[model samples]
Target: MPVHRRPPLPGVQRLARALALTAAATGVIHLGVAPAAATPADPPDRADVKAQVDQLYDEAEQASEKYNAAQEQQKRLQREAGILLTQVAAGQDDLNRLRADLGAVVAAQYRAQGLDPTLRLMLDNDPASYLAGARSLGQATARQNETLRDLRERQRRLDQRRQETAAKLDELEQARHRLAAAKDEVRTRLARARQLLGDLTAAERDRLAYDDDARAARGADRFDLGNEPPASDRAAAALNAAVSKIGSSYVYGSTGPSTFDCSGLMYWAWRQAGVTLPRTSQGQASAGRRVSLAEARPGDLVIFFKDRHHVGMYAGGGVVVHAPHPGARVRYESVSAMPVNSVVRV
Candidate 1:
C-alpha cells in the first residue's frame, strides 16, 4: 500500500494535456465553422432562352435531315444485300448440283475401269447405251473440268456477296446509331425548351404564345396572295390537297394523308395530284425544274434555309403551306419567315 507508481514527467504530462486541448479546439473549429457560400449563377432570361431553343430546333432539323438520308441509304443497302443473298443461294444450289453430277461421272468411270471394251458393251442391254456411255466418258471428263471452273467462279462470287452483305450490315448499324443520336438531340432540345417554359409564370407563357400568334397573323395579312392560278391542273390539285391538310400534325418520317413533315407533306400532296416526289426535301429539291422566287407559282416546292432542310408548297400570293416543325400544325406562313433557298416545279 505504501509503494506507489512513479508520476509521469511533468513536461510529458503538459505535452499530453496540450495535445488534448489542441484536438478539442480543432474539433470545435470543424463542428462550428460553416461551409463557404457557393457563387450562384444567374438564370437565363426569357429572350435568351427562346433564342437558344430556336437555334437548337434549327440544328435538330439539320441533324434530322442527315438521319433521314442515312435511313434511305440503309434501306437501299438492305435491299441490295437481300438480292445478293438470294443470288448467292441460287449459285450455291447450282454449285451443289454440279458437284453431284461430277461425282456421278467419276463413279461411273471407276466402274468402267479394268473392263474390256467388248465386255463393257455386253454389260449394257442396248447398243445405244454402250455408245452413250462411251460418249459420256469423254463428255463427262470435259464437263467435270468445266463444272469445277464454274464452281470456283460461283464460290468467288458468293464470297464477294457475303463480304458486301457484311459491309452493308455494318453501315446499317452505323445509320441506326446516327438516327438514334439525332432523335436524342431533338428530344433533348425540345425538353430543354419545355423546362424553360415551365420556369416562367402561366401569364408569361400565355403572353409568349399570344405574341407568336399575333405576329403570325400580322405577317399572313401582309403577304401578297396573288390571284394567279397554279401552273397546271396537277399543280392546282396539289395546292388544293396541301391546303386541305392545313391543320394536320407534323410528324417526322411520315408521308401520309394525315400527319406530315415538310417533305412528307409535299410528297403526299403531289401524290394526290398524280405526281411523285422524292422521300426527302433535299432529294425533292433536285427532282424538278428550278425556278426563281419571282417565277414561283402555287404548288411549287418552296425549299428554305441554306441547308434546304425545310420545304413547303407555295400557296397563291406570297404564302406557303408547310408543316413547320414538331409541335406545330401545318399552316400558311410567309416564305420570308425563313431564308428562301430555291423554288422547284415538280
Candidate 2:
C-alpha cells in the first residue's frame, strides 16, 4: 500500500497559512500533526442553545411590552366606558321620569271627556277674566305644547347617549381582547424559553448567565460626554435625566421615576425635559426629527432592530442610556451595541 500526498491548491495554501497564524497566535498546537487541511468543527451545543434561549427571551420581552401597552389602554377604555354607562343609566332614568310625566299628562287629558283642558281651566277659574284676557288662554295652550316637545327632545337625547355608550363599550371590549392576546403571546414565548433552558446542563446554564453578565459589563459606555455637544437644550436635559436613572430596574409597561422599559425610560426621560414621548418604542421612533447616527445628539432617541421595538436615549460620545430588557437595569451602553434602525431628535 502506497500513501499518496495530494498537492495543495492555491486557495488551500493561503487558508493553511491563515490557520497556522491563528494557531500560532493562540500559542498551542499538536506537536507531530502539522495543521493539515483545516476541518470545520462542530458548533458548540451550549452556544447554539443559548442563542435560541436569547432569541426566545427577546421575543418574549417585545410581546411583554405590547401586552403592557394594551393593558394600559384596556384599563383606560374600561374607565371611560364605565363613566359612559353611568351617564347613560342616569339619562335613561331621566327619560323614564319624563315619559311617565307625559303619560300622566295624557291620561289626565283623556279623562277630561273631550273637553278643551285650557278652556276648562279658564272656566274653572274666572270666565270674565278668561274672556277679557284672551292672552291667558293662548299662554296656557303654548305651555302645554312646549312641555310635550321638551319631553320628546329629552327622550331622543337619551337614546343618542345610550348609543354612544354602547359604542364605547364595544371599544372597551376590543381593547380587553387585545390585551389578553398580547399577554398570552408573552407567556407562550417565555414558556418555550424556560423549556429550552431546562434541557441544558447546569454548566450550560451557568455559562448563559455568565455570558449575559459579560455582555452587560462589556457594554459599558465608552463615549466621552464632553466630546459630543447636544443638538438642543431639551435634548441635553433629557439625556441628563436618562443618565440619572442608571441602575433603575426594568419593568414592563412602566414609565416612571423608578423603573422602566426601553421606551418607558425614553418617555420618562424626555418628559422630564418637558417633552412628551409616546408609550411604545415603535411610536417613539416617529415622535421626533429623524437624523443620522453621526448627527445624533446626547438627548436623541436611538431606535434599534428592524421592527424598532427597542429604544434608548443617546448619552453622548457614542453611548446610550436605556432599559435594556427584563432582568436588566437601566444603564449606559454603546450606541452601536445593537443594530441601530434610526436616530431621532425630539
Top candidate on lDDT is: 1
What would the per-residue lDDT of candidate 1 be over residues 189-216, giving only the tens digit for each residue? 6677677777767777787667555533
Compare the candidates by TM-score and give the number of the best one: 1
RMSD per model, one decimal: 17.5, 12.1
Per-candidate local distance difference test: 0.75, 0.74
Off by over 4 Å in 1: 1-44, 114-136, 211-222
> What pairs collide in candidate 1?
225-317, 226-317
Worst 10 residues of 1 by lDDT: 1-10
